[model samples]
Target: MKLRKLITVAMACIMVFSLAACGSENTQEDAAATETTTEENKAEEVEETAEALSGTVVITGSTSVEKILTDMIDEFTALNPDVTIEYTGNGSSAGIKDTKAGINNIGASSREVKDEEKEDTLAEEVFAYDGIAAIVNPANEVQDITMQQLSDIYTGKITNWSEIGGADAEIFIVSREESSGTRSAFEELTGVAEAGGLTSSAAVSEGNGPVQAAVAGNENAIGYVSFSFIDDTVKALKVDGVEPTAELAKAGEYKLSRPFLFVYYEDKATDAGLAFLEFALSEEGQICVEDHDAITVD
Candidate 1:
């Protein structure tokens, strides 16, 4: 009877050990399976978030800023394939108007914001700086100019290039539209605004491209444009002996410089719009700005 009891107890102990071992193995397998599932879930969440970031962002404003902004858009869209950006090369004033009316995601301007436009929730971000180059026909002999001379020329006081030691031909003045940011900044900086604005005889172009074209096509025409827009087609004259360049603009030596701006309504901003602005201020975006001949904000 004693032997029988001892054998029964040993068998029970073995059964319990076996059951415990099986339970331990099952628990480890379950933990591994749970960890794998959790990892998969995390990956799926990340993918979903990426897929959710899709939309169209509309940007309009300064024709002067078109080149740099287009380059930035190209790079940004490459990174975010789902995000679409549409840019229109309206003048800066029109851009500001669109932003104020919530008609565009952002407005581009190459000039300082006016005090009157500062009302309400209008916000601005300075993305870059640019010097306004005073361009002339390459055939003209005048190599440099002064601020007073420019002001006088635009105000119709100086009508002949010979007045400033150039060719004996009459000076053909090219001016931007009254609503142009470039025109505003140029007039304000060169004292033309104080002199009652551009003369009536000046040919008013709607954009920088037209201005450059006008100057390039005429041997006696003079106009102002963003420094980035200067090409071999036109000759950029020095203002007060200071050359219009990104380096000089950053150092404050170029008096014709202005800030490149992004104007938007804070409350009405969209996710993609904000993201695009953030990217424009990023290092990569600044590189694009510099690459396109604009001075970086940094």
Candidate 2:
């Protein structure tokens, strides 16, 4: 009887060990399966997001915002190759109209949305800030200008370059079309809007590129353009003794800055449209903005 009892105890012990070993193995297998499932789910989520973001997004708006937008688009598309973005350099007013009418997925603007343009369905995001630089040909010696002086120049009061300490020549005024957001913002900032708008005789360019080109080729011409558009061919004048740099604009030391906006109809925007808009506001997108000489929204 003692032998039988010892044998029974040994067998019971063996059975217990076998059960524990099996449980341990099963637990490890379960853990591995769970980890694999988690990884697969994460991948699926990423794939879904990418899939949803694949579509065409049409953007139209201010010529002032075009260069920065292009830079942002290049960065954004690198991360999302499946997305397509088309941009047209129409005036800000046309952009607003297109966005409002659902003709475009997004509208770019260098000016604030006017009260008359606001609606419940329409939404706008400030993607960046830009300074309107009063540019002159590099050959011109005018280095700085006061707001009052700029106002006078645009209003046809200061027609002679000598009136503002520059060389003796008739100031050839280069102005933007009435629908241009840059023009609206520049005029408002310089108090030219209140002084009866840009002078009627000023040569009007339809886009920033044209304005820059006209100024770059004419030594007597003076025009304003987005800071992003400034290049070696043109010299940007200091406004009110403050240099028009992104740093100064962000610090509020430069007074000629305005908001760069993305306008869209909230309810009608495509997934890709919303995604692109958010991307432009993201930290990475802001880096692209700064890289192109525009200030980030932050």
Candidate 3:
């Protein structure tokens, strides 16, 4: 009887130990499951935060660059509804100055930053190439002109449209205002040297539209503007029989064409700016430009 009782006690102890082992294993499995759940919740939160990018960025300057920003606003807002853009066309010089003062997130410039500019707060990106075309009233009937002829007209060297194969009318030269990048480009090509160097004889206007308007409204008037600015209201004079199309400009066949620039403060660049620039340089941005009758870098 004693032996039998002893054996029974041993078996009972073994069963209790086995039960304890199983309980411990179940607890370990439950703890592992809880840990995995906690990790998954944290991952979901990070994903949510990354998707929520929002802010306002402002850009101002060259009216020539306004179209690109117009295109960007539509597409960028569509992709990121939380972001907003505000822009203005105060001319390229105004834009550059505003960026330096930190009043604007970006500045638009057709001419590169000149060495004489007081501040060095700009970082630049090449956006597109612009062909500055010499325009005259459609009724003027001027067919062709060389670079020399253009310079002569602006310097009062050649006053009559007839000298360049047009009607027998005095050339009404409409020029760009001092702050205009178009003026800078015109001066560079015509050897006026700087903004104020235009001869006293040529008439001056404030913006591209005014230049076009001045020329279009007056049969004897002539001025220059970007190829994109040419419309039915004015005529685009041929330079050496080569038209100012984007393809011709890209090949450097158009003599007066120059690169356009998008400028910003280096310190003002945010994550949004980096992403937006990348998008603009990508296939999508190029496609937007092509659709809007503007040139792309490809």
Choose the strongest candidate by TM-score.
2
Candidate 2 has which clashing residue pairs, if any?
none
Question: What lDDT would each prediction earn against the true structure?
Answer: 0.91, 0.92, 0.77
- TM-score of every candidate relative to the true structure: 0.85, 0.90, 0.78
Candidate 1, 91-151: lDDT as tens digits: 8998998888888999998888898888677889999988899999898899999999999
Give the total clashing residue pairs for model 3: 0
- Per-residue alpha-carbon lDDT of model 3 for 1-80, expressed as tens digits? 99999999999999999999999999898899889999998998866744765687787888766666688777877877
Give the winner by lDDT: 2 or 3.
Answer: 2
Provide the lDDT at 60 for model 3: 82
- Positional deviation of 242 in candidate 3, in angstroms? 1.8
Clashes of each: 0, 0, 0
Order of candidate numbers by TM-score, starting with the best? 2, 1, 3
Model 2 superposed RMSD (Cα): 2.7
Which ranges in model 3 have alpha carbons more than 4 Å from their true place? 1-50, 118-121, 194-196
Q: What is the lDDT of residue 262 in candidate 3?
A: 71
